[model samples]
Target: MYCAELGISYEIVPTKFDEVKKRPFTDINPNGRCPGAIIQYIIEQYDTEKTLTYNTLQERHHLKQWLQFQMSG
Candidate 1:
């Protein structure tokens, strides 16, 4: 949804958590912390214009804070 807002195409790789801990997923993220690192990777790789994400430093900081809330709270 967010990626689409940024005009980026997100390719979904449907896999369970156990599968994510395996070989191919590890190649994408060694730590295997599924959506956190993976979504960040996708945003970085695909949101070339900084759309779907923060376009400025202040916005980036806000996004970081929001992510913390999202992941924890």
Candidate 2:
């Protein structure tokens, strides 16, 4: 939804990874988990924009902080 608000096009892909197969260690790091991996994959594959309304450091940092707040809470 944040991406949508930022005018970034995104899609959710179907996954077939069995959650049962992913154990304790795998779940420790969010990025190491299946769902996280899928998200990373999609982000890498889909992000083609070099700038979001012109890439300024302050604007980028604000966006990053906003995303952190959204994800953490």
Candidate 3:
């Protein structure tokens, strides 16, 4: 949705449970988890425009604070 809103070209690779437990996919996610880890990986790796993320240092700090708040409370 964020990528869609930003008009970025993205692809969603579907996977079976067995496939996700194998190589390549395992290389990307050693923990073999979905969603959270995957989303973070995707944003860090592919969000070159920083579309859904903060652009400035201050904004980055604020985002960290918000994430901390969510994690704590």
Candidate 4:
């Protein structure tokens, strides 16, 4: 959803349940997850050149806060 809004192309890679089981700590999270891990994965996958743009630092901060709110809720 966010990628579409931001005009970025993204693909959702599926993680196998059996593969996830090999890592014990993967399930010990809120909803069994962490935003940073997902964010890092996206960054690594799509932003390999680190070329994504933010018109301003404020926009970045605002997006971060908004993501935090969504995660918290």
Worst 10-residue lDDT window for candidate 1 reads 31-40
Q: Please list the C-alpha lDDT of all candidates, in the order they appear.
A: 0.70, 0.50, 0.66, 0.57
Estimate TM-scores for all models.
Answer: 0.51, 0.38, 0.42, 0.42
Residue pairs with colliding backbones in model 1 are none
lDDT string for model 1 (1-73, tens) is 6666767666876778688678987898775554565467767888887666877899878877776666553
RMSD in angstroms, all models? Answer: 3.7, 6.6, 5.3, 6.2
Per-residue lDDT of 38 in model 4: 64
> Candidates ranked by lDDT, best first?
1, 3, 4, 2
Clashes of each: 0, 0, 0, 0
Which of the numbered candidates is closest to the native, going by highest TM-score? Answer: 1
How do the residues 33-63 of candidate 3 rate in per-residue lDDT, one tens digit apiece?
4435444565677678787676889987786
Ten-residue stretch with the least lDDT total in model 2 = 31-40
lDDT of 4 by residue, 1-73 (tens): 4465445777877776445434554555435344555663564466644455344689767767766786675
What TM-score does prediction 2 earn?
Answer: 0.38
Candidate 4: segments with Cα more than 4 A from true spot: 2-36, 40-53
Evaluated at residue 20, the lDDT of candidate 3 is 68
The C-alpha local distance difference test score for the whole of candidate 2 amounts to 0.50
Colliding residue pairs in candidate 4: none
Off by over 4 Å in 1: 6-34
lDDT of 2 by residue, 3-72 (tens): 5644667786655565424565366654433333433344445545642322678865676665566545
Better of 2 and 3 by lDDT: 3
